[model samples]
Target: MGPLLDDARARGRTVVALSEYGITRVSRPVDINRALRRAGLLEVHTQDGMEYLDPGASRAFAVADHQLAHVYVRRAEDLAATRAALDGLPGLAELLDDEGKKAHGLDHPRAGELVAVAEPDAWFTYYYWLHDDRAPDFARLVDIHRKPGYDPAELFLDPVDPYVRVKAATALARKKLGMRYRMAVVPLDPSPVRGSHGRLPDRDEDGPVLICSRPDTVPGRVAATDVKSLLLRLAGLDGS
Candidate 1:
């Protein structure tokens, strides 16, 4: 890294690096979904010992992962009830309304009407029901497809290492190969663009599968390079 930086400096190229917001130690984990359920704003459908959101019956529901939650009200009439229910909650640090969203540039069509943020001492989880057995199938695994929310826990190694654990287990099952493999985590930016929330684009713009090829065969595959080139090709922008 030092040598590369030095070479870049010699070549008269400027390099800048920045980081996202920092994190602090968390003491408690808040389940915004559970809160909404308790408030009678969210409804669940149970089938075969699993639970899923009953969007038809729900007045409001929360999609939470990490410290942030986006609360959506199915009907406009339930907005006040949702706000009043979450107000003065212990772990909640802030609840951003329409005014706050406008101030924060989060009032876009894709943005939720209400955003619930947890305190630094607490983080948010996606659990809507209390019982572990009742959790949705996606909750028990590293399934990103079924869960319609963000999951900051996927970035860490603790509690669950979705990528590594799955790969290791797969490798152990096929040990006859006696080979090592790598994994590349390509992040498809899910940040909502105005008027594009919850709706798929007419064509592949920037959204694609979360994976490319297996690590061993990635050297000359479609996504051989970094994530940027891979994503570009996936979007049919790079003229693959």
Candidate 2:
């Protein structure tokens, strides 16, 4: 917890947020209107003008047109907008900060950074659609989705790993000009062991992905992903 927070703080972020809020906050609403669309691994949308979805976000939930879904917040302007929308809640900032320290640890760089700029509130609501296995079932993506007339219902969805994307987000915010935040989750594969010059440590209060320093994350493993890659991929630079 201490190290991960140290890492995040060293870089900077608002707080270590879980992809859970960004992904599944309001996805599985008690009311869902299925049969909206198909064939989209990702569905991007806007709710009250906020970016709502990106790659790995679900389409089965008909997120393409749903006003309830959410998307990853990348840019500072966008993040600021989000923080604004979340106003009205009291102590959200402190709670997040204390929780952050508790979550990331007292000395994580990422946590330190997040505490520096964290707000007192984060809008909360119901969105269950975000939790429907954001991670792809490699087998299904390769076999079932490729097969003719694959049944969406029959297709096996990989369990959601909200931390992977959130961790990446924290890392990206770290490289930002001034975003202090940390993310709590089980670190992604291709651990920093081989990438970060061996800064690998154990779990923190944030649920694994303990911060340390700039990860020397290897080029491949899925867990090795960071915000730079995720954002660039969103910008259509995956092939590069």
Candidate 3:
């Protein structure tokens, strides 16, 4: 990597290093959907002893994403009640309504009716089932699209499952043999997830970063939204 950078420098090419966001250590996993379900706002359907979220039939539900969640309410009248239901929920730092969404630039039509932000050292989970035995088949597997929310637990193997590694190896062998396989090794527990990011960083050092080889084209500080314009400027395509 150093040699490549040196070669680029020798060729008079500009280099830029950037990151979308920085992850911070987290210990708490906020069961946001479970909270909504406990309040009777979220609904689920049972199939073969497994529970799956029924968004269409539900009054309200939460889509957890890292340290934040988007709460979708089916009815306008349920908005206040939904907010009240989330009150005192552990690790929930803030709940954003219409005014709050507008202030945060999250008032788009596609945005959820309410946005939930987790505490600094916490993250939101999509687990809606009250019991592990009733969890959906995909809960123990890394099925990103089917989960209905971002799951950091997908990064780990089931720590309590003694045969998790063996099953994973078997799945890999089956895949290599061009056979159907299910890599159901991911954990249902979110406690092992030690890092997450989504909420605004309390300090600048904890946020995203941008570094440019051409000092003249770089600003003293850069916001995440300004990165694109800065890149265009660096590429001499912005007519700046």
- Clash statistics: count for each candidate: 0, 55, 0
lDDT score of model 3?
0.92
Between prediction 1 and prediction 3, the one with superior TM-score is 3
**Residue 239, candidate 1: how far off, in angstroms?**
26
Candidate 2: stretches off by over 4 Å: 1-52, 55-72, 89-240
Report the error of model 1 at residue 12, Å: 0.7
Candidate 3 per-residue lDDT, tens place, 40-139, comes to 9999999998999999999999988999899999999999889989999999999999899999888989888999999999999999999999999999
TM-score of each: 0.64, 0.19, 0.98
Judging by lDDT against the true structure, name the best candidate.
3
Q: What would the per-residue lDDT of candidate 1 be over residues 28-143, giving only the tens digit for each residue?
A: 65677777889888898898899898867889888775667788898789899999888877778889999987875568796677987777566666667767658665664456
Name the TM-score of candidate 1.
0.64
For 1-240, candidate 2 gives per-residue lDDT tens digits of 778777767767323222311111111111111111122222445444333333344433211111212223333343343334333333122323335446534444422212221121112112222333432232123233322121222222223454556665666688585766433332212111111111112222222232223234323222433645654553457896
Better of 1 and 3 by lDDT: 3
> What is the alpha-carbon lDDT of model 2 when measured against the actual structure?
0.30
Residue pairs clashing in model 1 are none
Task: Quantify all predictions' global Cα lDDT against the true fold.
Answer: 0.62, 0.30, 0.92
